[model samples]
Every structure is written in structure tokens, then in C-alpha cells.
Target chain A: MNNYALSISFIDNKLLLKFSGELSLYSITTLQKQLNTQNILKIKDIQIDLEEVCFIDTATAIFINNLLIKYEKLDIKVSVNLNSKDIKDTLELVKNQKLHSDKLPSPDKESFLYSVGKYIYIYYISLLSFLNFLGNLFTTKIYYLKSIKNIRFKEIAFEINESGVKALPIISLTSFLIGLVVAYQSSYQLKIYGANIFLVDMLGISILRELAPLITAIVIAGRSGSAFTAQIGAMKITEELDAMRTMGFDPYIFLVMPRILALMLVMPILIFVADMMGVLGGMLVASLDLQITPTLFIDRFNEVVAPKHFFIGILKGPFFAFLIATIGIYRGLMVKNDTQSIGFNTTKSVVESIFAVIICDAIFSIVFTNLGI
Target chain B: MDKVIEVKDVKTVFGTRVVHDGLNLCVNRGEIYGLLGPSGCGKTTLLREIVMLQEFHGGSIKILGDELNGISHSKAQKLRREWGVLFQAGALFSSLTIAQNIALPLVEYSDLSQKMINEIVEFKINLVGLKSADANLYPSQISGGMKKKSGLARALAMDPKLLFLDEPTSGLDPISARDFDSLILKLRDLLGLTIVMVSHDLQSIYDTLDRIAIIDNKKIAFEGTLDEVASAKSEFIQTFFSDLK
Candidate 1:
């Protein structure tokens, strides 16, 4: 197949060649011949229309970079019209890299130290700002309470069912497989000690304390967190937030509260489902590899994993939900009235939500460990 | 004339930038007041302050004789019901159909039955000149002018006594802009509603406004009827008029 197509048109004494498809090593010779036939040497202005081009790898980018350099030397103005912003950004980055290849270097000793120091300073400031925000959140409990009072319970419940219930099957399947893997991995080592029953303790504790919460948080971060960000960010960029305020609606109460409450109520249920699936996954592995009956596996699971473990797992649910929802809304609200800001805040919301969940989980782990629970 | 909105010595700053420095203006009931200025002249900021969306550094703002600061959150929200704002980009929810978009406020604030809500939505859709069939289509599936009309329909759903429009004719063709202007004029005449608009479109301002407030030099440059503004002879006003000549 001819992987590339090139169309050349002369308009207003300008050579406008629209290039579509790929520009590869094989196609480069054909492109060169076509350009030569057009008397490119005499062309004053050459416009490369990349509007239909799909992919351009490093080699093709380099070839184009060289062509641009050669055209500049021949006193021909070269312009490119690209379809996708990603492609345009890649080309710009490639051009910059080519132009500044010699000047670029790994950071020196002092510069590295300075960079580390700067990062440290930024991290410290961000942490302080987060703490301050949390402090404000607590101090203004009345504001939160008032906002909470305005939440539409029916609407929030519907949204919870939509976001949470619909995601159950996949979450359950994945966690079940995770549990099975953990059980299978533990059985081999436990068999060596003739203490295979300890596999239950290991699998149960790990899933309840760490794996379930972490997996659920990650899932929700990608699922509900991104949705919250996109919804709020879009609203922000479109001035719907402003419209809500203008229409005698408190945006925080109408928008943020509903989502927050929905997530808060739904997360615990999701976590419980995840834990059950994880145990079932362990049961599957136990039944298959260790020749243990399902009933025996359940009894073992019950014996080793205490009620506190379940409580601890459940306790982390609301905190994780709060972290995800709060960060999503906060980052979304930070969006400026621009498309770039909206995208930036959407990505920021997902990353920040996941990061906050993990950090909060670690704190909970530390506190639980210290309390000897 | 009864003042619907009054801003006295209002100042709004964004970090280090002073967007509105001691700005003051007034809009009378049943009058269409246009805030006219170049881009980034704090017209949007002024609108936000009037709507109680932005906090003023130092000033007293009274909406329908209620002190802006003293008004409770619910009271402010109730006051907001008095005005409908059509944002620059229409701000329609992409996921919602035109009918649902129009019905949002009514569903949220009113205790109307679904049949009543549907009727109201249909009435609004027709009021903005959109067909009943157009109600099922999402915002992204429609044209820009249609989206603006849908937004206006939603804004009008609350049957507001006051209306605020920000760049209502922006990004629209001349024909669409004219149609929108005519619609605004018709709404005002029919409903006897007060309108506060921020726009740089001179034609829209002249065609619809009872009086125009020109913002320049961090304050109101002039506030009067269009003819009076035209005769002011200030350099800014003169240049502005000459540009359209």
C-alpha cells in the first residue's frame, strides 16, 4: 500500500503542498522527487499543509526539520499547517531539540542541588496550603452544614446509583482476580511451613488493609474523580458556575454537595463489595491449588480476619471518598476561563485525588499500627 | 425611577491587578443599561459584583434596595432569581438536551409537576424561536446561534424581572447578532423587564440600550443616552464613534 499521499497546488505564486498519511524513509525519496519536479529551488514561498497527516515519527520529523533548514538557506519561506495540536507541539519540540542540541546537558552539581531545593520548597508550600485549606474546612463547619442542607438527596442518590452501581461488576471481577492471585502466591510459601491456614490471615489482612482501598481509590480516581473534574471544569470554563450563582443557586451547594454526598455514601458500599470479591478470589485459588473446599476456605477466612479489620477498611472509605471528591472539586474550581486551564485542572484533579487518597491511607495505616488495633 | 441595582464606590482587585477601582453605576427598573468598554476593561468584573458573585474590597452594593453585604445566602439566592444572566458562550450543559437545559432552573427551584415543567420548557423553547423537535438534541449537536437562543430560553425560564447579558452577540454572524438584538428588545418591551448588559458591540448597544455606561480609566467615562454619549466629544467616545464611521 502507498502509505502516504502528497498533493501540490500553486496558488498566488506560492507552492502549497498538502501532505497526508505517513512520511517515511520509503516515501521520502518520492517526496524529494516531487519537490524537485516543482522547481523548489525557484519557489519563494513553500507552504507544507500537514492538516491531514496522521502520524510523524522521529525520522520523519528530522527529515522535515532538515527540509526547513535547507529551505531557509535557499531564501524560501517555509510554513506548516498541522491538523492536531499534539502533532504541532511535537514538531515544535523536535525543532527546538534540533536547534539547541549542543546547549542541552545534564544538570551540574550546584544546579541539581538548586533544583532539588526548589522542589522541596514547592512541596513544603503545597503541604502547608493543603493543611490550611483543611483547617478552613473544619473552621467553617457551619458553611459546610448550610451547603449540605441544600443538597437534593434524591438527585444525589440517583447519581450514586449511576456512578457506583454501574461500576460494581468490573470492580468485583478485578478484585476477585487480585484475591485469587494473592492466595495462590501465599499458598506455596505457607505449604513449606505446613501452615497453609496462615494464607487466610495474609490474604485477608492485606486485601482489607491495603489492596482493596488502594484499588478502589484508584478506580474511583479514574472514574468518579475524572467525571467530577470534567463536569465542574466544563461548567467553570463555560461560566455555568457564574450562571448558577446568578440564578439564585449556590453552586457549591447545588453542584459540589450532591457529588460529594453521593461519593461518600457510595464508596463504603463499593469497598464492601470489593472486599467480598477479594475474599472470593482467595477462595477460588484455595479451592483450585490447595484442594480446600469453599466452606473450609470461608471458615478459615472468618477465623483469621477479625471484625476490626473490616471496620478499619470501612473507616477508610469515607476519608478516601472525601479526599477524592474534595480534591476533584477544588482542582476543578481552580480552572480559569480557558480551555487549557480546564484540561490542566481536569488532569490535576485526577492526579491530586489519587495522591491524596494514598497519602491519607498511609496516615491511617500509621495511626492503626500505633494504636495496636 | 426606582433603582434595581446600585453600586457605590466599588473596588475589585485580583491579586495585584486592580480590575475595578472605585467603580460606581446604577440601573433603573424597566431600563436596559449597557456597560460598554473594550476587552479587559472590567465589565465582566462589574457584572459579577452586581450579581454578588464577586466580593468588593470597599463599597456598598444594593440590589432592589437590599444591602449586598447584609443579604443572607438564601436571600441573595432569592435576589438572584430576580435576574437572569445569559453568559457569553451560552454555557449550556453538553450532556443535557435543549429542553432539559431550559427546565433546569424550574425543576430546581419550583415545585411544578413534570407535565407543567414540560409545558413551561416548550413555551420557553418556542419563545426563543426554537422548534419543539429541537428540544431533544444536545447542545453540542446544535449550531452556535441555536445554542445562544437555547441559553436565552433557559435564562427566561425563571420569568425574571431583570436580565443580564454578557457579550450576547459575540462570535455570531451579523444576521444572528441582529436577530438576537431584536429578540432582546422584544423581550424587554413585552415583559417590561430591566436589563443590564456588558458588550463591546456598538450596534447592539445603540439598537437596544436606554442608556450606556462607558468604562475607561478605571471608572465610568460617561453614563447617558446614546445620543448624549455620541455628543460627549470625549477623545475615547469620539474615537469609538469615528471607528464605526
Candidate 2:
């Protein structure tokens, strides 16, 4: 189907190129290469004969137009002879496509300074928008306090099941393994100093004060935070949020509140579970590595590790939950009207929430140290 | 005229809910053929089956001399390049600009140079009546009419011999719908394409379709020109085309 019969002849400083038999994109390349070898630069005129050609696609038509435009620029006279109405229509579509005039150049690369300024501008705007989102969230909650019975308890239960309960097994396994590693590593230094009995105090304080809360928050940020962004982003893309607004339902109250409330309520319980599991893992390691029996480990843990350490760690739970949920939903609401935006926002939510969790943890650490807790 | 598509005794069943039973139709070369049916009559399903997007339970459908049922993978891929299907939503890739979307098939299937590919993309954009300035815009930035035209341009990118359109004018305004109708007729005349469209837009059917097959009660009740369908005794034809007289 691509066999274009080509016959080129040069006479009296004029080039005559005849083409027929189904010229299309597949044949245009070969035709252009063949025409390039001919010394048409010295010619005064060129004539493209398509009288016998029955069909021509848009690509071939554009190729022919490009040839004509090139010759016109070279001050050489050009004429295109065509027969079929189909070919005539194709040529008419591409008749005005000049090479340099119609062709779009690749976009210029942005300068480094320009990109830096652009990112700063974007972050500043996002910061303001986030403050605005926080204000709206508080006002919505305050307004809904009068009709607290109208809140969706069923949706909150569902969120708790999905984000909190479903996360139990993984969090338990991770924190348990982390506690075992920390206790085992500390056993070596204790044994060297002949202070192996102190393993209980170290494991209890570290797991209760740092590892359990921090690790639990990170895992939830990875799991449920990303889910919130993807769920809300998809809803935004499908216009479900708009549909809810049109139905006189606020998406913030209907969609965002249940998730936030459920996470805030369940965060402390999950953290408490993580703390127990991490201590159990450390106790197992202490018994195996240092010959500290469970009873002895429990006695020393109770004597030295005060309840304030656990309470302090649990105190950070709701704050971390608020950060993760708010950042996730904010990124989700920022999603544009395309599928790609969902993925972009989901990634952003995971990263930003994890970062916020660590920063919040650090601030808590600093405040407790100054207060001598 | 040579037959470009032939669907013989095709049957489609979704878990015993029979959609099409013993459906038969033939589309000739260089004509705009329409599949007209009420909602849930499986016109889109039939179009999908013909394009190999969906499989039929029984019977054979052939296009461009290749049988669709149980076709080889390599042969199916080859046949796929022989036609272009414009989905209902224009289905332009959200990640790419309009020009890149139109140039995708050519870039994937052909060895054309970048310069030639760009020129061909421009030609197609102009062919579908889109402005050259709109080439760099994403699909979300364009209006409904522009999106449909961009989709038509992408469908025509490979210069296929056959074109399948699913409700091309369903979401367009009246002026845009008529413009799309004339554009279809013009493209058919210019490219000699054998088009198979599933549409219920009566105005589009009257304006562009050379022949139509109406499906009712799981079978083709009428298959002929508009004038021929006017006299058919089918209830759907009577009710749907009654105002045409």
C-alpha cells in the first residue's frame, strides 16, 4: 500500500518529480531522502507531478507543502500538479503550514533563579491557603457543635476501622522488632560496664518516650494519610465534592470531619498498643540476651520507668494525628481536575505528613527537656 | 463496493442477560455507517466487540480481512493499527499536551523523523479545525468542543482506513454538534474512511450517516438508508423516526 512510484527527471535547469500510487507517511521519508540527493539547488524551477496519485494522507500533503515553502524561501519557482479531489482537500488543509512560522519550537528551559523564585512563590501561597483551610475547619466544627447529633457516627466508625484497627498488625510487628533491636544493641554496652540489670530502665524509657510514638506516627502517615489524599483526590476529580456542595452539604463536615475525629480519637489507643508491644519485644530480647527473666524485667521496669514517660509519649498522639489528617486532606483538596494530580497529591501528602510528624516530635522533646519532665 | 466490515450472527451475553442475538450488519467502503439503538440495546457493546475491545459470545466479525475472534496477538496488534477508535469522553491522555496526544500513534508505530511528525501533527490539528495555538494546552484546559476535535485529530493521526466513534456528539452544544457533523462528512470524503459510529443524536444521524442499522429487542430491526428505514414496520423505527416525515 506504501509503494509510491517515483520518477525524477531534470531538464533545462528544471527538476520534475512525479509521484503516484498511494503516497503516505510511510513513503514520505524515502521520497524526501531521494529528493535530497538531487542537486536542485542550481535549478531555476521545480514541478511536483501528482496527476496519477489516487490517495494522499495529511503527512504527505504537509511534506509536499514543506517542500514548496522551502523552495519559495530559496527564490526558486515551484508548482504542484494534482488531479484527485481527495488529494486536493488534503493539500488545502496543510496549505498554510509554513515550516518556521507554523512549527512550534520546544519550550525554553527555565533559569535556575527563576525556578527558585517560582518555588518560593508557590510555597508562600500554599502556606496562606493552609492557614485559610485551618480557619474554615475550626469554624465548621464550631458551627456544627449546635447539631452534634447530626454528625456521622457511622462514618467515623468506618474510618476508625479502616485507618486505626486495620493498622494494628503492622504497627505491632514493626514496633516489636524495633524494641528488640534497641534492647539487644544496648545489652552489649551494659554487659561491658557490668550494668546488664539497667537494660530494663533504658528499654522502657526509649520505647515509651520515643520509638513507639515516632514509629507509629510514621507508619500511619505512610498508610492512612496517603489513603485520605487518594480518596479525597479521586472524589474531587469525579466532582463528588461539588455534587455534595450542590446538594447543600458541606464536604468539610461530611467528608473531612469524620476522618479527623476518628484519627484523633484512635491515635492514643494505637500508640498505647505500640508502646506495650515495643516493651514486650524488649523484654523478650532482655531475657534471651542478658538472662533477665520476665519477672525481674517487670520489677526493674516498674521501679525506674515512671508513668510520666508513657503519658508524655501518648500526649503527642492527637497532635501528630491532627497534622497527618490535616495535611493529607489539604493536599487532596489541592488536586486539580486530572488523574495525574491525584498521584502527585498523594505523594506530597505522605511526604509532608511524615515530615510534620518528625518536627512535631522534636518540638515535644525540646519542651519536655526544658520542663524537666 | 467492497465491504470493509462484516458482522455475521454475532451474539453477546453478559451472564445470561442476552444483549445481542444473531446480529448481522455490513459496512461498505468509504461510507459513514451508524449503529442506532435505544439505551441498553448494546450498540456500544457491538462497536466495542468489532474493535476487539470487548469479546462476543458467538459469531465472527471480520475487519480489513482479519477475523476478530481468537485472533493471534501479533495479528491483533497489526489490525489495531489499521483503525482508530474515539472514545466517548475524548480520552486524551491527561499527562500530555494536545499536540503530543495527536502525535502518539505516529511516534509509536512509525519511523518518521521528529520534524515530519510535528508537521503531520500540525496538519491533523488544522484538519480537525483546531487552532495552532491550542497545540500546547492540556486536555483539561480546552472546552468540550475543542476536546472532541482534539480527540478526532488524535484518532486521525495514523491515517487509518477505518474509524470507530462512540457518541462523538453526545456532549457538544448544538452549534458544535453541527460543526462536528460537517467535519465528519468532510473527513470521510477527503480520507475515504469507512466509519462505524454508535450515536443516538437524530440530527447527527440525519446529517452524516450514509446508512444505519437499528437494534431493537436484541436484533437488528432495520438495516438500510434513512428513506428505507421510514417504511420499516419496527416499533422503534416508527416512534423514533416518525417526526422525520
Candidate 3:
């Protein structure tokens, strides 16, 4: 039902551009390219015709308003002709708000100094907030120790079941699939080199040492981590967190601590289960695809997969869980009292936790390698 | 007075349940009309339908003389500027300061100068009995009653011919509720606005409404002036009055 199209025509010294589509953020690029391809100095005037424009949003309005300012500054007489009352209303809104708005210059229009200053300031503030969050978490833990009876054991158990037990089926499936894929791909190369029996050795070491914990943490970051952010953010939006504070209860102790503790306690168990499933998957593929019997696969797997490698992988679990829970809680707590903020923060929580998990995994590998593990 | 809002044979159905059927209501200029009923009686649903935020199953809602049924995009935007809806939470933009919230509509819908916009923002803020200093505070920084006032100020920003208030006094204290009622009355007198309020506040109903429409058994069981509503012999009306007391 959205019949949108744009066309341009030249008349003497003026360019007549007609917009028929929903002139929104999606169409701004084409609009910008039209301006880019045209030689502004050769054309003295440009008229935007909005007769058939079906809709216009704030982003489009801001873009057009900024474009007009640029044309005006360049001595290009720009005008807008409209028959649609809808376009008039949108432009009217943009015009009224233009004075107080942050004149959106497309990214290329932004000054280098402004970008640098803005990003630096943003990062600095984010770092400070993170430190503050850690400090609050530490003090809350101390407070929980003093009032152990006040701690929400019931909620912690509920969270453990939700984040740990509920995640079992999906985690097992992903781990098995990854292990099968890894074995299938690597066994072919090993077979060509007449090292077919080495399939179990390679799969076992890789899955237990790196893949299992890393993949599980990544999955949990997207699922349970985002859930934490959404739950906490919704609680914040409904003012339940505020209500707790005013009622002489620390939200950190009652709300945040339980979630963080549950995730931290559950991650090792999840990773261990993931390791078993993954190795089993490798054994299945090795026997079926590589002609290695199940007994031979097990013998090689047991001989090559060292306890030190398994220990090193599982040790990263608590750390990954801590980062995921901490990042999630931080993002959720940072959420402003609005739907947009909740959505934005939940997305940011998932992305940042996954990134953090991978980075921490890399650091763990490097430290373990240096320690001769 | 010309009717600003006229709803005829309006019907709303959800799955197997019927929310409204053959419901008709007419509101006149410079008058406050109240809609009252038990919970889930579609009072808010009717308000949403009237505001054009929702579509009815069957009805003709003629707003300010323009029929809302099958209204085009351009016509809808035009109609939107002529009326404002105040949600129960005030629904102020959280990121914007109070003045920015009030100025949003004017900025979006008018060609007024920056100074003029600021002046109008100040005027609206003061009209709602807020200090000009409050103009710089965010919605979160304000109390519930103040948020309602800010919401009202924003609702009045575009100088809408019709104003819709949804549960305006639900979370307010008695003094604040009374103050809100007086403010609504004062605004009606000052601006000649046609107000459509959905409320359960008996004080608000008695203080602000000139006419009341009560819903019962899925239709308007009673409709009349406040005094008429108070003395109506309908069993539902009697219990409403008694239960509220």
C-alpha cells in the first residue's frame, strides 16, 4: 500500500524535485545523493515539491531543515511547494522545533573536533559510571554479609533455575551442533593427511579448552543477559526499584545481588555440561564420518584432553558470568524512564556483554599460556 | 453552541466480547463532558477512539465537524493538531526538560519564533501553576501532581480546540485533585476549550463536569447534567453515587 517514488526535473535555473514516498530516514540517503550529484553553483534555485508525500518523520524533517540551511548559506535560493496538508503539518513541527534542535548535520557534516570531544566525553562518563557501579556492588555485598537473613535466597534460587536450568536444552543443542561442525570440517583435512585418528584429539582439546565456555557465555549473554537488562529496566520504569529504596531496602542487596550471584554460581555448571555435550557430539561425528570407531575416539579423547585445559576453560565461567551480569545490571540501571531507553539499553547490554566475554576469554587464554597451563 | 465532537452508533468489539455498541455522545464547545463507568467499561477505549488513536468497529466520530471514519493521512494530521490527549501518566518525554515537553507541539506544529516559543512555553507552565524555574527540570525530577500539570501544559501548547484528559486525577492527593479540577475549570473559562474527560474521581466529576455519561450493560445507561446524574433513579447510578461516597 506504500507506493513511494521520487523524481527530479530541471526548469531553467531551478531544480524541481518531487517526493512521493514516505520521506523518512530510509529515504534520506537518496535525497542526499540527489543533492550530491547536482551542481549547486550551476543551479540558482531548488524547489522541493511535496504534493504526493505520504508521510514524514522527525528524522526526515530534521534532514530537510538542515539541507535548507546549507543551501541558504551557499546562496542557493531553496523553496518547498506542498499540496499535502500532512507535509505542511510535519514541516511546521520541524520549523517550530528547529531553533532548539541540535542542527543535525549528516555524519560527514560533523566537525572532527566535535566528534572527538563528544566521544571522549561519552567514554569518560561511562568509565566513571562503571567504577561507581562496581563500588556499589562491593558495598552491597558487605551489607549482605551483615544482614544475611535480609538477602533474598528465594529469588536467587528462582534466578538460578531460570538462567541455568531453563537454558539447558538450547545450550546443549548449540554445543552439539558446533562440535559436529568442527569435527566434520577438521576430520576431512586430517584424513587427507592420513591423520584421521587425530580428529578426537583436535576436537576434544579445542572444545574443552576454548569452544564450550566461549559459546555458552556468548549464548547466555544474548539470552539471560538481555533478560536481566529488560527485567531490571522494566522494574526501574515502574518505579519498583525506587519504592524499595524509600522503604529502607537496598535494591542492590535485594535485587541486583541475587541475580549476579545466581549467574556467577550457575555459569561453571553450564559450561561443564556444554563441554560434555560438545565432546559427545565430536565422538558421534568422528565415528560416523571419519571411520574412527567410538572406542578409538574415546581412547584418543581421554588421552589428549588434559585436566589443566578443562580447568582453565571452566575457571573463566565465573568471570564471564560476572561480566555479563554486571554489564547487564549497569545497562539496566542506566536506563531512563522510557520505553526507548529500555529497548536501547537492553540491546546495548547484550552486545556489550558478548564483547566483554570474548575479550575476557582472549585474556584468559593469554594468561594461561604464559603460566604454562 | 456548535458540537465539537459527535459520535453516532459507535461500536467496538474485541474477539467475542463487545466493548461498545450503538454508543452515541455529543460534546459542545467550551463545555466539560465526563464519561463514567465501572472498570473495563471502555471509557478509555472510547477516548482513544475519539482521539483517532484507535479504530472503532462501527461508528461515525465527527470531530470538530470532520468525520474521523476513513480520514486521509493529511486530514488526520490536521485533526491531530486541533486536539491533545493527556494520558494517565502525563507521558512526558523523559529525556526532555519540562519546558521542552510543553514546547514540543508548538515547535512541531507552528512557525513561531524561538523567543515566541519560549514565551508560550513560559505562559503554559505558569498557566498550569508551575514556576518558570520548573521549566528546566525533567519529568522524572517532578512529583506525580506536577507531572500531571506539566502534561496539561503540554496538552495546551498547540492551543487545541478540543482537549482530552484521561484519568487526570487518579494518582493525585485530595488537595492536588481539587487543584487539578479548578485548573481544568479555569482553563475552560480562559480558552473556551471543549474538554472530554474520562474520570472516576467523584470530586473531579462534581467539580468539573457540566454533563455526565454513565456506561452500563455495554451502552450509555444514563446521560445528563451533574444534578441529574446525582438524582437519577437508575440502580447503577445509585450504587455509583453510594459506592463513591
Which numbered prediction scores highest in DockQ against the true structure?
1
The sequence of per-residue lDDT tens digits that candidate 3 reaches over residues B127-233 is 99999988999888999999989888887888888898999999999999999999999989999898999999988888899998988777898888988876788
Clashing pairs in 3: A93-B108
How many collisions per candidate?
0, 0, 1
Show the lowest summed lDDT stretch of 10 residues, model 3 chain A.
A240-249
For candidate 3, the TM-score is 0.48
Sorted into a CAPRI-style docking class, model 2 comes out as: incorrect
Residue A206 of candidate 2: its Cα lDDT?
90
Provide the lowest-lDDT 10-residue window in model 2 chain A.
A239-248
- For model 1, what is the error of residue A156's alpha carbon versus the real structure, in angstroms, after optimal superposition? 1.7
The reply for model 1, stretches above 4 Å from the true place, is A1-149
DockQ of 1: 0.71
Q: For this target, which candidate reaches the highest lDDT against the unseen true structure?
A: 2
i-RMS for every candidate: 1.1, 14.9, 14.1
Q: What is the lDDT of residue A129 in candidate 3?
A: 96
Model 2 CA lDDT for position A91: 89
**Residues B1-245, model 1: lDDT tens digits:** 98998988888888798887778889999998999876788998888888887888888899888998777866877888877888888888776899998998998889999999999999989888889999999998999889889999998999999898888998889998998999999999988889999887778877999998888878888888988976797999777667755
**Could you tell me which residue pairs clash in candidate 1?**
none
Q: Write the per-residue lDDT of candidate 3 for residues A173-246, one digit (tens) a residue.
A: 99999999999899889989999988887887899889999999999999999998988887777644542332
User: In candidate 3, how many Å is residue A132 off?
Assistant: 0.8
Return whichever of 2 and 3 wins on lDDT: 2
User: Model 2, range A1-373, lDDT digits (tens) per residue?
Assistant: 6568788998777799999898988998899889888887788899889999988999988898888888999999998898788888888878844423655798989999999999999999999999999999998888767586757797799999999999999999999999999988999889999899999999899999988999999999999999999988877775445423322246787779999999998999999999999999999988999999999999999999999999998998999999999999999999998999999999999999999999999999999999999
